[model samples]
Target: MAGGSNTNNYGGDLSEVVRQLAVVAQQLARSSINNGDAQGKLFKKVAQSTPPTYQGELDPTILQNWLREFEKLFGAVGCLENSKVGCTTYYLKGEADLWWQQNEATIRALPGFNWTKFQDKVRDKFYPSFLLKQKAEEFSNLKMEEMSVTKYYTKFIELSRFAKESIAIEKAKARKFESGLTIDLQLKLCGQVFETLDEVYGRAAHLYALELKK
Candidate 1:
């Protein structure tokens, strides 16, 4: 049964959310593994056994990078026994997830940016968070020292809100495309991906709607 502290992973055990959420990605990769046995090893080698472009988004370079980072940032067991007083693993996980979320927001909030440029910005933001946590592991400042405590607190709260909201929206999109789940897990998975894109594009739709209302 799918269950966890829906109250939230307060202790930074992000694996629950990541595991539940990555059900789609994990299943697809697994399918490739299964096919490798049946269709010979050659076909199994290619992750995307098809042409890599649709509409305007190319596969496995930009969007795929963000997807993989999101999985790693949010979808793992975060535990660090770094005995640095209060340098808990929970804190590390929170920063990583928060980093993933801010980029998600930046990408979503861009109204007219090129997709490639948008992706580059996401990767750019990811590295800083990675470095901050690495520095924190060494009893150094988590970089919160650079800002006033109030500002740091506010930043944490803002990122926390974004991550939670984004995950909820993602889950809602997943549920929407769940109808054909029985026909084939692959199609159902594609449906979920498209559903997510719908939400991403819906932000623009919503803005245009508001402009019309005005």
Candidate 2:
């Protein structure tokens, strides 16, 4: 009796042998699929174990976005404490890498390099106090007229980060965002209730799209 064969002296039966071979082949195929699935899961686990690399030059807002992604990635990986060295040098590229090289000695000399404090240092280097103030002023004076609705909203959101105290509440942020829109958009949203800045932006974007088609 070969593997997967009956004990009825089935050796002389070619059909029985063929049937057993087919069954064996099917079992092998199933095992292969199971192994492939296990390997796929392992690959995904390893890939998500580390943060994604940061590419290109550094700007205050751009670096901020990168840090946000880095935080989320490492937090998910359960390695937030190792963030200082693990997230910085390994993932840097282009101008960011050059900046790291130039400041490597000073960075290494810091007594206790806290990631949050290091972020502040990077922000200060790119967006000084004066520049933040200027951006806040610009955000305050921005109007939707003559500018595309998307650009106006994007600039508002970008500058709003520095104006932390001003747009702290969703209601206040929504009001400020609405106030910056064109009179037509304001009139369109007059009777609507928006709970967040994002909601207001959504409605305003829809109205702007309609306005464009008219």
Candidate 3:
């Protein structure tokens, strides 16, 4: 009968629609699983790097070193920008973990929160403004004096972090470093066209060695 033929055609169309929806659901499930697996792999890579733990140390140097270590590891592993705070916070223990837990919700609620913001927050919490100013002053007054070229260079590099803007550019860094060297060394390096701190350091070291021999 014609009526029976119409019912069969309608049922066939309904079944095909259901089948298409089922296929889409399956694809979505597979995509979700793949994404989860990739995230797990990335986290594992971060763990293998053995990132340092922060325990709410009051020492600015310790906090700065810990932050620097994480920065290095993040660069080495090619960590995702969105995931950096999560990864770094995982290494928090003791008082540091407690502080993060207490403030996590509020910090997360802020608009446009990211790694740099996180760094600023941590510094604000741990690094006092007066101490930072003092460190900057020490860097400004640093001089080679009797220190060997290598030792002076080491100190310069260490203190430079506190006064980043002073030597933000290569030429300024070279000039600032040269200004701290002994008068003899400065005279030797004067009127030269050094473009970088490293170039100035190399020439200074070579000159210092020659002076030691003489």
lDDT (10s digit) by residue, model 1, range 12-53: 567676777799899889999885554443223222232122
Provide the lowest-lDDT 10-residue window in model 1.
81-90
Which lDDT tens digits does candidate 3 get at residues 157-183?
988999999889999999999999999
- Going through the candidates in order, what is the number of backbone clashes in each? 0, 0, 0
RMSD values, in order shown:
27.4, 13.3, 3.1
Prediction 1 TM-score vs. true: 0.16
Where does model 1 exceed 4 Å of error?
1-96, 128-214
Better of 2 and 3 by TM-score: 3
CA shift of 118, model 3, Å: 2.0
lDDT values of the candidates?
0.39, 0.74, 0.91
TM-score, every prediction: 0.16, 0.61, 0.78
Looking at model 2, the pairs that clash are none
Off by over 4 Å in 2: 1-59, 76-78, 93-99, 102-111, 191-193
Q: Give the TM-score comparing model 3 with the true structure, all chains together.
A: 0.78
Quality of model 3 by C-alpha lDDT: 0.91
* Candidates 1 and 2 compared by lDDT, better number: 2
- Candidate 3 lDDT at 55 equals 91
